[model samples]
Target chain A: MTEEQTRENGDAPRGKEKSEQILDAVKERRNRQRESAAAEEKTVNLVVFILDGDFYGFYGEEIKEILPYEPVTFVPGCPDDLLGIINVRGDIESVVNLHRMMGISPGEPTRDTRIVIASAEGIRSGILVDGVEDVLDVPQSEIKRPLATLDRSIREFAVGGETLYNEKYVTILDVGKIFSKIVH
Target chain B: MQTQTLFLLLFTLKGIRFGVDMEGICGMEPLSRTSEREIPIGWFHEVLSLEISRSDYQSPMVLYLQNAKSHFGVIIESPEEVNRQIDLENIRPLPKLMEQLCRISPVWGAALTSGKGEKGIVLLTDLFRWRDLSLKIESKTATVAPPAVS
Candidate 1:
């Protein structure tokens, strides 16, 4: 029987079968392209730091440099988060206590404390951290949103969270939002 | 004040320990030394006002070692001592228990946790930020007069 006559007799049609095979091939190619794009987008580097005995990280690209802690000049009538101004490389930067920013008690600076220099919205500021951990390669799929119970300020500052191989939670900071308010 | 480690005079209130940075605190004087009549209106009613001598010859301010909002003043029954040169490494974050107590007042001192945990240092400066923000909001609301009735 001819192909049209076979379809009328309730048999598999030749033309319909060929079109289905072509459609399947297009879908398979599209899926392969999408998978590779997703994989490429997930790769990024981050520098992690400890604050309030908890681990937090920010994208490495956002950080300018990490420096040793120096005495901060106290300015009267400044905001509580502002620990005063510090002279870093002849440029004055506002030093902020991350503990205070996190709405936690401020810890006195120890030998472990490090000042992390970062630029947000073109305005450079320094954040005092309890200690510097290490730089890590964190993939995008590993990051998730913060729990609802986390502090509201933390939620605002963090873009997402990641769980390390050891299963500890690491929060990824959003530098743009952090600096946007300060720059204005 | 130039020292790396800050000293704080630790005290107890409502069964919780609270601390203030030694720099922010002038000297802690006897409660009997200051007269209650000189105390401010919003000062903690339960605390016996103590004279706090500060820089810049202004009037000596009264110190109240109690939660001002709740008016629960804690009496320093025993002699209070100062904790000196507490290293930052030694001070740990506030435990879940102490954090709850801190919300009641901004004047909490140092909290001692059990099981070899480090003492939690409380900063009156940090604690007052929340109160200051609330007061600003309140003042703004009060200053803006409501629409007058027709």
Candidate 2:
């Protein structure tokens, strides 16, 4: 059949359509890149961890390292929040139980317990979490500011919130504000 | 020497002696049983339920302490007592000692050598530094629940 006749009849051969599909694919890829770049600008990297089945994360840059849970020496007269001192590479680092800090029931640590080493205002400390989850690229648009009526203590520690694809909630902690009142 | 006077309210926890400033402490009372939900973070040991008579309504006030800014219930073994005041001016700063103690406990300002030649005074607010540490330990370490006391 002649090209014009086929075009007018709308019965173009399959080979002619291949080029159009390729063009559409390139356009989709460019749109995806633009979307990703915009997302990257708004969100910060967060290392997410689990505590009592709830998801929580901290700014990835704020975390120094993640270590295995080690035995700590309990000190008398220490605050109930103070888990004890752990010897991390010969330096004693105070460890806080994230579950206890969140007012959750204390659960025995298994192999999953991980110590997240973080520094706030030059005060180096370790936080014990139930387990270390994958690091997420949380976008700023997903974060929701905490409501004013939230508990005073809880509000002080929270920086913002992030929503997961499955519609689950994750709290982004403000490590600096948590330790701002503490004297180093 | 001109001395800065600091009034301390002394208390005990797990048989260890520590003191907080009188100004930091609102009040103290005998430790009582508290509901599990009412206790705040970092204060697992100090949670207590107490009754108060204010105006025509009698309600319960949950007395909490700040450990590194984390609120925990205060379980007072004995009624809080106002211990003697120390002169801050007379006290010498123990930078080395304070740094060492900070690793283990929350000690901020210290008062060295009272006029009568006693141990130096250590500020109690520094104890809050370990609030996260203590809670972390409690969660990981297996603990036997204390027997119910009548």
Candidate 3:
């Protein structure tokens, strides 16, 4: 509020107190606006990878590490998407075949094959990828909702995607949906 | 409530990719090791009638469908991959008209698969119903078959 708005029909001491209160209120509003602008300007970090030759990405905060592919023990009766479990240090983590989950044909593991250890909502698992591309800071505006052409099943969990100037398309997956699939 | 995730074995048959539930799948064997000639005459005809070219019988891969009682083999080009775990929520059921038109349509659903610069459709098979149909074919063949030649 302006100084004129803060003026009151009162004695000098009381008017000073009212002016001081108005000043504090104005400062608070200015601080809130600055915080909101900062929040909007912040960029999102993503970890990008290739699965069955298609580019995919996950929030960088959801990833724990990127490790080379290791031998996994076959677990009977487990879902086919789960290759098996691997020993990540002292911890055993389930490795998921993202290619198969995406309905893509599985490709042979090569030198570029890597396991992405990702965690979301307290659930952690490893996803097998053809290769780890890079970590990028994508502006929020660059990300758009998935198109109508995308299957409802996949589009439900796809948090939109970003297109690079080079025309490379990257779909960002919803990590929570990725880890929440029930194992048969 | 049940978790909608399912384990499926993905394979390509007649140039189109299809997925079948892994629950009823006993295992996959190379056709060279277990030749199509070994299959009984009754079940063999049923397989041939399903539009799969007789030539495909010589394919390299054989997926065995099994329940508690018996097993039947399906000849496919190859076992492309086993999707050990897949969330059923990501699978879309075929349109009502498509299902109604193809009464024996082995595929109950489909999903989109992306590749280099293009996308393709992947059909998902209904494992339980598919096995039931196979058994029905076997039983029908047994009941209607003519006497074996001496």
Candidate 4:
């Protein structure tokens, strides 16, 4: 309405000469929308680790803990991938060798080796790995499907797809499927 | 709350220690002292499908386990007297995954032991399950026996 009223209301004095101010208003609106969209993009925490020189990960919710690898009591009569069972604090958890399960001949464990305790749907067990790399939140949309060329054993349980992080490709593991296959 | 003390007879087969309920344990005696024909004999290694050798059971002794009316003997290493009375609370149930993986082994549960010269997880086995395994072994041996007789 009046020039004084426009100034008091913080409204742009309307006219062709106000083009710069109009552009600023558009920019501010765009930034607000961008921030809200970013806030809406779902993210999930992932526990990524190294296996046979490849990066693999599990959803953070499925991973209970990671402990320094220790000697596991060799359980007889189990498949080779089933390394054995271990004493975690007071609980008895069976450990599976991911390298052997994927048909890779594993070497001796190094100092960085870890036992990842995974619990899904009340079923729990330990997964032996060469080492753990990182635990971070990854945008769910960034995860892609497991490479079609992956071995059948990996494809059998691989899920959540793969994500590129820190210059490495981290394939998400389907922990529930892993437990189901191991159980059934 | 009442605490139950689980009595187990401890032994090792190929250095892999295992335990069995002492309740069903009839006795332990030298293989030479018993009538071998009176009770069927099954080697612990053979029952467990572990690598078996003639010398694997060096100084082997017979551990008798009884069920209901019938009793049987299994060849095992000499009992390692590492505390037969285990706290029932200490026996940990096998992880559900292991329960499915340990189909052939008679392992019902396990106990994590420490100090007093006992360390690591001791596989608590069920001898009666081994007796079940023994029947399968006997049937296999019998199936092969007729060809030898003929």
Candidate 5:
């Protein structure tokens, strides 16, 4: 039977099936390319870190480097959040106590403590964190705006949050707000 | 890296620790044998309006401060150690809530966490500005618009 007659008669198109397989492969690849482009536009790269046993994320583009905790010179006449300035490869950069800035109880710096150097609004500062977690892609659809129940200080610093599959809410910090407080 | 340091004189008042920039301090001495009433430190006299104890009157120390054309002395409880190399950057500026509670600009900021237990937040004050504001307030009260003629 001809290919059209065979399909209408509930029989597979035996001879045309090879060409159909090729067409299906091309269509599937095109669909994959479109979906990949969409995902590339919709997802953001984040450098996640642990703070007080909670996960938080920062834009990967804003982060310069994550270094081991260094002894920062204690300076007076600045905000408590501005812990002190650290010398990072001959560059004097302010190290901030993120815990204090978020109004969380300050903890002792442990071996896992790290300083996340972030640049925003032309200002470079280091954020002291408990531990460096993972670098991952978070879909935009997963992130939600800061909620009313969040602390006002924290809300000011956080751009959005995302609940992961394990039910952990990762708060994304706004680099502009984090650096704005130090500029002055 | 070597950072700029702020020299401060730490002292206690009514169980609270406080600090002031030592830049303006010209001299300091024990208040023993000195008459508190005649003490030239106007700010010290002003603090008397608060609930000061009799023991506080006994061991107070006088700090003579000089800034430009103005000079004054203040009596605080015993003078603690002089922090000669406090990093100026580590000082914590007062938050809006604290500013509202204090209602004074001379109260500069607090010290960062020192990891000590219950060490309490030390209130840092600007010696020069505190004295200047005190003088302005004194001048305002001194210039009593002559009692309205009934």
Candidate 6:
């Protein structure tokens, strides 16, 4: 607001104290805006999903799309984690089981099962999950380092950080790291 | 845009459908009529190490492959598609990690079919690339002489 708008009276008041008060108000507003802009850069958008009764999330930008259980053709000699390949329209995409990678019991494919097609670091594939929870815009500050007691296998590549989402603790996954493991 | 028709010889094995390039298939015959001395026959699943339910082939058919001196033929199950054609663009390469597996497996690519009652990905197998393995264990007792000069 202009100096006149911050005046004690609707008309311009003539006083040194009054003018000083108006200047202070304007500076406070500017400081607030700067703070929020800094925080915005740290905010991250995530897509949360459920796997083996645990909550997990991936960066929103890494996920390309989510599709229902499609016909997956089992390929011989493929690793256990590589469930199969599916026909996405005319494109062929490999379906991966996250439960196997996370060391969790694999759940049977059901109506709630979803395939999240994600791409990172020039690698792309469809990750099969038990269910999808929700998408959230979480602040980076809320994301905490993984538990010290966590297994060395999972914490090394999969875990990005953990945070609370909808009163549930979600383990953020590092998409690029996960893709690299499969590619390598 | 120019559209190319991909001719494939499709067949079923252990309930999964597979296709091969028709340009390489020379002829097809019933298993009983195929003579071992003339051409060597190999099981499709065993040659490429494809996993499937083991079952007796009561009426297995042999597909003779061209461009091989051994005159190799592959035994396949029912629903043999001799000259089925689909769009060439429909065939896509195996994604990422799976592409590396193709180095050991015969299935290097796949195609999607939307035809009525036959809608799914058809795995493309290349038997011609692994022709040398066709004659393995064909003659148990005696080894036949090599093919004569044509």
- DockQ in order: 0.02, 0.03, 0.02, 0.61, 0.03, 0.58
Q: Report residue A111 deviation for candidate 3 (angstroms).
A: 1.6
The interface RMSD values of the models, given in order, are 16.1, 9.9, 16.7, 1.5, 10.8, 1.6
For lDDT, the strongest prediction is 4
The TM-score obtained by model 3 is: 0.45
Better of 2 and 3 by DockQ: 2
Model 1 chain A scores worst on lDDT over the 10 consecutive residues at A73-82
| Each candidate structure's count of clashing pairs | 5, 21, 9, 2, 11, 0
In model 5, the runs with Cα more than 4 Å from the true position are: A1-41, A146-148, A163-167, A182-184, B1-150
Model 2 ranges off by over 4 Å: A1-40, A147-152, A181-184, B1-150
For residues B25-58, could you state the per-residue lDDT of candidate 2 as single tens digits?
4444333344444344223233111121122112
Candidate lDDT scores, in order, read: 0.55, 0.56, 0.64, 0.78, 0.67, 0.75
- TM-score of each model, paired residue for residue: 0.45, 0.45, 0.45, 0.81, 0.49, 0.81
Q: If both were scored by lDDT, which would come out higher, candidate 1 or candidate 6?
A: 6
Candidate 6, RMSD to the unseen true structure: 5.9
lDDT for A174 in candidate 6 is: 84
The residue ranges of model 4 lying beyond 4 angstroms of the native Cα positions read A1-35, B1-3, B32-35, B101-105, B137-150
lDDT of 3 by residue, A1-184 (tens): 5555446643244345767899999999999999998887777898888877767788999999999987664332245667755556545566777776677788888999999998876767888899998898887777776556765555655877754523677778877776665331
Better of 3 and 4 by lDDT: 4
Docking class of 5: incorrect
Q: Where does model 6 exceed 4 Å of error? A: A1-29, A32-41, B1-3, B53-58, B68-70, B132-150
Clashing pairs in 6: none
lDDT of 1 at B27: 36
Per-residue lDDT for A41 in model 4? 78
Docking class of 3: incorrect
